[model samples]
Target: MEGFLEGIWHPLIDNEKCTNCGFCYNYCPKGVFEKNNQNIIVKNPADCVDGCHGCEWKCPGNAISFPKPITKEYVIKVIRWSKAKGRNVSKDFIKYALKNQIIQQDEVSKEMRD
Candidate 1:
């Protein structure tokens, strides 16, 4: 997938709790997790998209923990990445994020300029 967040955010698997059922391996759309021999491991954490938690809930053993904080920088990064890919999501959403104080205005300005 394009613009996958990779290192910015990735799932943390608990080895002690993991049942090795491969749920994350099967469910990850971007191939973030892979089946290694009889076990499963995250092969490309950076390939995981921002704010995506599909693997967290899919793990029956509850071994996944993605503790990525969604800061203003992350918001801006996603916006810029999407725009660079020609996905014109509504500007109103950006305005709303600013008006609601979801992101700092300076951060948005810098992102737009970039």
Candidate 2:
């Protein structure tokens, strides 16, 4: 699950529209953005909390954007792929999907329900 999500859903900063106001750097609780001299970079993209859009909403320049939006279908696809690959999809990930409203409780597999 971590491997699949590592670079999948992180924010992308468009430099053209970015004013380097540091809103993303300051607002992100995951330390995803870091100040590099006068510029901001996504330093720890993998550390970003899944389904969070706080930084995007807080950015005054509207420079922050995610590659993909979290949705029930997307979550289900990931779970199915992980299972196909014989990966142990963690219950915490399922719980996170449910808590974030990305997927409903019934969408989780019967084996995953426990």
Candidate 3:
């Protein structure tokens, strides 16, 4: 999910495979994910570092995979471009991003609450 004019990337979680271990949330570098309830949810996917894939790697369930390959350089470049163009990002972009990636909102929010 992009934030403001910056094209920020977000994480998406697969509920079916997620073990609810919370490893991803605990290991996440940025405040990107927050766990909400039993089901993992995607709250602030934009803060996720592009191509970090830390959560996905740590997931024993193999429940995580990006819809598209994400890279830190790509995110930085897209954000820089968007800022230069002065384009305001929309919520749809975020929703769309959540469609991809291996994280969820409820888990993200739950982790935040902890």
The number of the candidate with the highest lDDT is 2
* Steric clash pairs (candidate 2): none
For every model shown, the clashing-pair count is 3, 0, 26
Select the stronger candidate by TM-score from 1 and 3: 1
Give Cα-based local distance difference scores for all models: 0.75, 0.77, 0.58
For each of the candidates, the C-alpha root-mean-square deviation to the true structure, in angstroms, is 6.4, 6.2, 14.3
- Candidate 3 runs further than 4 Å off: 1-8, 70-114
Model 2 RMSD, rounded to 1 decimal: 6.2
Order the candidates by TM-score, highest first.
Answer: 2, 1, 3
What tens-digit string does per-residue lDDT give for candidate 1 at 1-39?
243554567899999999998888988889988888998
Model 2, 1-114: lDDT tens per residue? 445556577899999999998888888878999999999999998888765567876788888888987677777776777678787766666766788787777768653543
Clashes of 3: 26
